[model samples]
Target: MTAAASDINFCFPVRELESERVKLTPFIPDLHADLYFQGSAAYPELYDFIPWEAFTDTSDFVKKVIEGCVRPDTGIALYAVIDKTPTGTNPSKPTSANFAGIMGYTNTSPANLSTEISYALILPPFQRTHVTTNAIGLLLQYALDSPPHGLGLRRVQWKANRLNTKSINAVQRLGFKLEAILRYDRIFVGSKTNAANGERERAGDPRPGTVGTDTALLALCWDDWESERARVLQAMDRRS
Candidate 1:
């Protein structure tokens, strides 16, 4: 049986199995308040990583995420990573969660077998930790365990701005093979001017400027993921 067929309980409304050190829960409404306030305060460094040019208010960002979960075409599957706290005065307190580490496929254009691993964000505190690695492992498990698409998924893709070295390193460590770089596929603020136009266009607006920059695409096949997982687990065991 395919991974999908064996993993029926992996669907939405399902609280994904908590990692040995973390819990993966579906995003909730009130998290907006905590995440917007505490997250921004705690992990200000994250502003440089993910796109947040459009979030003006807490409610606006929350609403946008909610709409994505409910929408069909551009909607996404989301999860909040709750770090395990030791038994203490506030054992129930959540230490960290990826504010926008939204994981899900987009443009399953090739029917059941092919899907792209799209957007994900990790708040600063969670970086360099096992949270993202295991969270993604869970996501991959869900995808592979589900029917029709199980194991048949030819690729699990990760695309990011070439400047995002942290993301690049993390995905690489997770065993994703670095693929080709598409030149000038993405435009950026620094190089937003076309050769003909002397002035640089605004960041969000579409212009003829090529930026001469491209998104770096990385990919992991089932074998790659399994190998990576084994390596990660082995490293964790050695550390323990």
Candidate 2:
């Protein structure tokens, strides 16, 4: 029998999730400075993919966090990814965790027992590390585990810009299968400036100067998770 939305206790206000290398904490307004600084200072390339580049300022980040990320109805639960590894040479000394990036679930649909993973933003240094792999594994575990452990979701979806080969490759490695390409799926406002010359030239006729991007859809359904979960956890355990 399919569990109704009411039957599942969705983690509200985002709960804390931990892995060996990192910690995921619910987004709070007080994190505005940390999030802004980590995102802006580490790499300029972050602005290329993330649409919220304009929110580098603490005030804007706070406003956006309140209005978009933390809002209960938005169906987007944000988490601040923090690095838990010890930094200084002193092994016994306690070191504070550093904010590594942001990631979360979006377009959550409890009624359908499905959710979309979105807003993966790992800092450049944290890239290629097990941080992302473990983050994803943890999220998958939470979304797929049965009641008393997780949301018991039937499906978890991942969508990336078709041009984002890095993102596609990452998900593919993590066990999400390619589903389909959504043609001209999203219209990014002011994308013209960022679009390549060829892309701009090809924007002919109907929407001359507009820039649209195709979306690549991928998913790991319940059955797939059941089959792959052990292998995935084994890989994560090795990394952890």
Task: Identify the runs in model 1 with alpha carbons over 4 angstroms from their true place.
Answer: 1-15, 31-37, 41-45, 68-70, 86-112, 145-152, 188-213, 235-240
Every candidate's lDDT:
0.52, 0.68
Over all chains combined, what TM-score does candidate 2 have? 0.81
Q: Candidate 1's residue-wise lDDT over 77-194, tens digit each? A: 4456555533442213444333423344554434445455554655556556666676666666555443443444656777866666777887787677889765555544443232
Off by over 4 Å in 2: 1-13, 54-56, 88-97, 191-208
